[model samples]
Target: MPTTPVVSRRRVMAALFTGVACMNIAMAGASTAGVLIATESPGPGWSGVPSAAGVLGTAAGALGSARLVVSHGRRRSLLITYGLGSFGALLAAAGAVTGLFPVLLVGLLVLGLGNGGAQLSRYAAADLYPDERKGQALSAIVWAGTVGALAGPPLIAPAARTADLLGLPGLAGPLLVAALVTAAAAVVSAALPRSIPDAHPRTPETSGSEGFAVAFAQRAVRGPLLAMVAAQVAMVAMMTMSAPQLHQHGHGLDVVGWILTAHMIGMFALAPLSGRIADRWGGRVTIFAGIGTLAVASAAAVAAPTSHTAGIPLSLFLLGYGWNLVFVGGSSLLSTQHRKLQGTVDAVVWSTSALAGLAAGPLFALGGYVLVAVVAGVAALIPLVALTDH
Candidate 1:
């Protein structure tokens, strides 16, 4: 008798991690390009517009992808989202060539949708592993992002040279790279298994509202949800403004890239350790550690001089590190609870994060980096209100 062949979980996870790494490359490249383009444009407070639009798209995309995951599956949803990202990157490239700010904004919005979908990859990783290793699985996938994140900023110069050689606008070069990478991600996503192990299988009769109610009713879920939201708000608000703020203080692109690279390292380099901490000590304890780290980081940011020096990079790194702990720990907590409602729970988390990103621009404009840092510090403290011994 012929035996059925089984796909290895390790292979599936490896493919997923590769896709996520590619997606992060595209995202980081777009971010660097957006900052340069927006800064060079003649306008007051326009630097944040692209990021805001992208974040709004991310919010919408998260909800949309969640619904698609519920209806179709992870593979299809990821493919569609990556396709949208490719289209968005093309638009962004064209906009850069034409020097059209509005078009660039629109393109970034579309790209954000893809980003939202990519964020789901972490959750998918959790589904593939046993409960005890959930944190490790999720963090391993997230750690894959380090490759792209660290590489993207450095590629800005090379991409610009490539654009010049191709007779395209220098700023548009990264977007072109983004388009190619995102398309590759889509192809890779197509190879994902039809069904993930331990994934929640709901009937067509199940509704998003039903999932949401189930998640909200549980205290275990609610606390982690709040921690995730707070972490996102604090992280996004500070990180988005860091580049522009440094640029305004007369830092060059290379310097900015280096600082951002350091930040990205902090974000992904310690994922394995963070995951182990979460698994061994519990998510709540990890969250508390993250909050304390964020508090100190924010204080350092407020005190750091506006120079192209080690101070800013160190501060940013700390900030990123703190965010990583909260994100991985909180996500593990969520994954452990109400596994059946994963999609809806993720939607809520991403949507809240999107809103926070959207709000960051105006907040920065109002009170400068110090105000933003203060606000972020305050937000970081929110998880304390819902702390539990569990």
Candidate 2:
């Protein structure tokens, strides 16, 4: 295996970290604005459009960015991705100002593309480090999201006020902030040097779907990818639809916000520790633990009564941690794959997550939250059972 110089690797890692953190800041703010945009329409017909568009964009972005990475190297590909994000944010802001729903959707879709590029940065970071160090590096990048989660929300009102001063719609303020922040991400991404010793050879992956098929046929690729996908499906389905269940139970938006905060803490706060666990115990054990925790969390949700809000939050926290473990562990395992396949796998992960989210409402309505939790649990078990062969 090749080795990157420690200094060079660290510099690139720091760049990826800063870029992803900034992108998330934009994402959170834009997401809030998107929800508002969706709600601007009467009734519940369009409530989920913004999120759906973003997810679909993320899926497309991941595939497109990965191809670019194959042909153009990390730096150039990242530049294009984040540039798209910034432009998308600006377009979305224009939609807000003009009251054009289609424009807002298009902008969000583009912003999600940029976000997809940022998501792939974790893989680029992995490529810079040795096998032993990949977990720590990936975790460090994932941990950067905590900064966005903490900082993004507070900026919304101020951004809205700033927009008011500019004579734009108040919601456009956050989108404007998103534009600036994503452009900063583009700048940070521009600073990434070729950290790989044998960097950017333009692999066969750029050729066509055949390359992806061959790569995915490998045992190493299949296990980690499947585990990662399961984690995503479970997490998105359970988490996205939980709010409706809370609402049905008469819980207010404040309670929902507080619970989601707990979930974010569970997701991002202990990422370094999660990385350590993966590095120490190996991916198989880490994924097993993750699956177990997720299954338990799902069961807990079913067991907890509506009035028992405390239990619900605890379950959500557990859900987030479970997802972190699966994702971090699976990613570390997948790190050894060909560079071109990285973005492709992530694209599939996001697409599956979007589908799960779309199905969540219907699943929840069928048997209420119980059915959704059951479905998530079933999804979690797929990789668990299959990876037993690993």
Return the top candidate by TM-score.
1
lDDT of each: 0.78, 0.78
Residue lDDT tens for model 1, 1-390: 221223656767877888788878887778768866886784425666676667666766676776777778878888999899899989988999999988998998898788778877888788766677889989998898798768877777688889999999887988998899889989988888776555443354643335566667677877877887787778777877888788778876677778888888888889999899999998888888888888887888888747457666877888888988988988888774433365555566656666665566677677777887888889988878787635
Name the lDDT of candidate 2: 0.78
Per-model root-mean-square deviation over C-alphas: 3.2, 3.4
Looking at model 2, which ten-residue stretch has the lowest summed lDDT?
194-203
Each prediction's TM-score versus the true structure: 0.90, 0.86
Alpha carbon deviation, residue 110, candidate 1 (Å): 1.2
The list of candidate 1 runs beyond 4 A from truth reads 1-7, 42-44, 199-214, 337-341, 388-390
Question: Candidate 1 has what TM-score?
Answer: 0.90
**Reference-based lDDT, residue 303, model 2:** 84
The lDDT of model 1 is 0.78
